[model samples]
Target chain A: MHELTTTRNNYQIDPVLTVWGWEIPVYLFLGGMVAGMMIISGYFLFKGRQKEPTCSCFYVPWVSLILLSLGMFSLFLDLSHKVYVWRLYTTFKIASPMSWGAWILILVYPVIIANIFIRLPKFVTDKFPGLEKYSKMLTDRPRLIQNIGVANMILGALLGMYTGVLLSSLGARPLWNTSILWLLFLVSGLSGAAAFVHMVAKNIYERELLAKADNGFLTFEIFVIGLMFIGLATSTEVHQEAAQMLLSGSFAPVFWVFVVGIGIIIPLIIQLFAVNHKIQHTPVAPIMVIAGGLILRFVIVNAGQVSHYLNAHF
Target chain B: MARFAMVIDTKKCVGCMDCVVACKTENNVPEGYNRDWITQEAFGNFPNIQLEIRSERCNHCENSPCVSSCPTGASHYHDIGGVVLVNHDECIGCKACVASCPYDARFIHPDGYADKCTFCIHRVEKGDKPACVSVCPTNCMYFGDLEDPNSDVSKLLKSRKWHTLHPEAGTNPHVFYLT
Candidate 1:
């Protein structure tokens, strides 16, 4: 070229933009997984699958409370002004994902409690006979129980979508800017829930049923993730660079190897073989699915931070 | 209503980082954190390189993502001059704004709130310039009400060929750089 004169701004500052840490990703992962668990249990209740001894609907609510509480605790630790967190509930912001999530969580507690009450296990009734009346009333009213199941499904869907929307609405990170992120999160959440059920179910039929469900959800999750990447890549240069961060840049190895390879692909293949009876089912694949789900959130959250507009050399 | 804005002349910038120091001292930024910073772009090969030193900070965008991302309305646009400011008491340190800021301008102060360049609101409220603008040795920084056509920043924008940090992001940042 004729007298090459290139202009670039290479001076960089450390710790300039970074703020979030491990807490956020952990919160997101747990929240999505819990939402998935709620949906699975709700669907089972709606379908009257409670007759099965190993029905996930029996214990998912109780387990969800513990998991969600842990997630919330992690979130609480991230807040600088933990005492002022009540301010978030003082007002409802239609535009804020955090506000919506707060209200959804408030509603989720009652639904979860009702779910557990309606499907109280024998150990609980045996130990505390006094609580039998409430359980009896819930069990007696089939229509009312089904209605609660529907409510759980609706609320669970909202919670699942809200987790991803929380990050995507920020619009600052191109990797999170894609509209399909919420869908990917929802599908992944459902897959994790299915895998969780597959691992814990005592009934072989129920276990196989959940394993098959997990296979379907995992496939759908992969498709949604592909869409998310495509959506980002086809957008502006900044978004394209953001996609590259996951594709072949610094985050590629972890994303492809850990998240995609070890987390998803291997599990999907193994599960398919297990379902076809070509191989005996092991908890390894379902466990991998859960681990993959968690890693997916970590990769997305951290990679989004690395993908910035200014850092990209246009 | 006035719209506050800052314009930096890259040609005049020495990247001495006086602005960064002044901002930290004036704002009492926590240790290991900053409210403003500088970025240098050097291009070309060998001795024939073209270098551009940019003193950067929060763009204080007209369409601020931080404002919308904040659930408690802690990060808000000041009606007086369109300055993006965070109310520390109301902020829960959720870091939503920190993650959403395309400019990477915000940080979680040790005090447990999101903070960024406020354009020295305390000084500006007293009819004074921002600390960084007032302390620039090369006079490369200009801060004024863009709403006032006669203001220094407005005049500079009109007279100079300027570019914002990320026009593609569509945040409509108030900070402009004159090449």
Candidate 2:
């Protein structure tokens, strides 16, 4: 009863901008968080201040491995040829940032895994049974793990800054070609790590200790967020367009609702108002901090990817 | 010693995508992928319309960003001829070159190495024209050695005004388009 209508294809589609996608930003966030966790754990270990061995020594490495694995997997998934991904290491083009990142991941992952193995309770217990009781006794002593912590810190810092430098080196993408992007990434990474640790600590530690760490992480997050914003705002037009996309363009709602609202504002306010007077045992602050950190990565990744190179306006 | 280059006349191009199809077929370009393409910019939405067409591929720049961004040294510009090629064995499928390229020309091949228009170096080495040049129905595309003053390309360069895309990138691209 109805005449079939074949619609003419009037609109032409430009080749989609396919360079950096959700993976790059997410990788940056994950790498930064790992670096942050390593630094925090390393600092605490070196100080011999073992407030909670399970949280710092055990959980940090485990989480780092998990995040690292996930980040690397995301990178591979984004590759057009997933099967030959290993060839990237051998290709060794000095001009390519992706090649550098691949090599860095190869080196960093092994070191982090080894560090985790050394701290695992079972490994320590089985390898040196004689030191078991002494090791348990030494858990609370911050001085015992200080060296490991320092190593972690150094490694973590490199991991954090690499994400920023990687993007900045692409001068063609005016949006990412800036030195400040590195600093912003570094600071945000540390904040994300602190938030992660605070969350983990909340679940493992007693109320009082959890509250203190949450407060510390929340304050640190606010400071870093401010720095990131300032860095983004001061950049050149190309970078400004990227920032504007987050602030008001297609990426605005997610940027504001998730990155700024849930990731920064909500967690900050909860820590400042709702939990400030509460006893240290509450789980809310830590949970909020973790939620905010993840959301921050999501919004940033999406925002950075929405712009195109072909547009005259860009 | 062999410096490869291409000159395209914008006026002669009819937006028929002959070069695109020819390059794809010659190079065995995978389905849903393109190594060379024609871009058309049409003005005046309705009734009164004018269109400008551009044929684009890897410019084989002197300062190729794809080469520098590849961590594995898989992508490199040949020092002798300045033709960019990928060393497939060394590439790790990282896509760094793809991101760094301003023209969006390089792509990850199915084998995991970066791939782009090599200016048909294989055919050139055999003293034959590139597939696109030989097949172009309108004779819109020109290829030759830029170094030899007697070459047709060199003669064209001397006589015609031409421009390269994203000259601000400082890549010193070999491909020139005459308006």
Q: How well is each residue in A1-314 modelled by candidate 2, as lDDT tens digits?
A: 11112111111112434555677666777887787777776666665545554546556778888998898887777665566666665455455556566677777776565456444567666877875565454445545356557777777777777877887787666556656666656666766666666655643442334345545655655665565556656864555676666667776787678666766666666655534564343446555555666666565544443343443332
Residue lDDT tens for model 1, A21-100 = 78888888888888988998888889887767677788888888998898888888878778789989888878889989
Alpha-carbon local distance difference test for all models: 0.84, 0.67
Local accuracy of candidate 2 as per-residue lDDT tens digits, B27-78: 9987656778877656664667666577888899888878777776667777
All DockQ scores: 0.44, 0.42
TM-scores for candidates 1 onward, in order = 0.92, 0.82
lDDT of 1 at A176: 85
- Per-residue lDDT of A15 in model 2: 47
Give the residue spans of candidate 2 off by over 4 A: A1-14, A18-26, A50-55, A88-94, A109-119, A127-145, A202-237, A278-281, B42-51, B110-113
Off by over 4 Å in 1: A1-18, A122-130, B44-49
Which pairs clash in the backbone of model 1? A8-B41, A8-B42, A9-B40, A9-B41, A10-B40, A10-B41, A11-B40
Per-candidate clashes, comma-separated: 7, 34
Model 2 per-residue lDDT at B177: 87
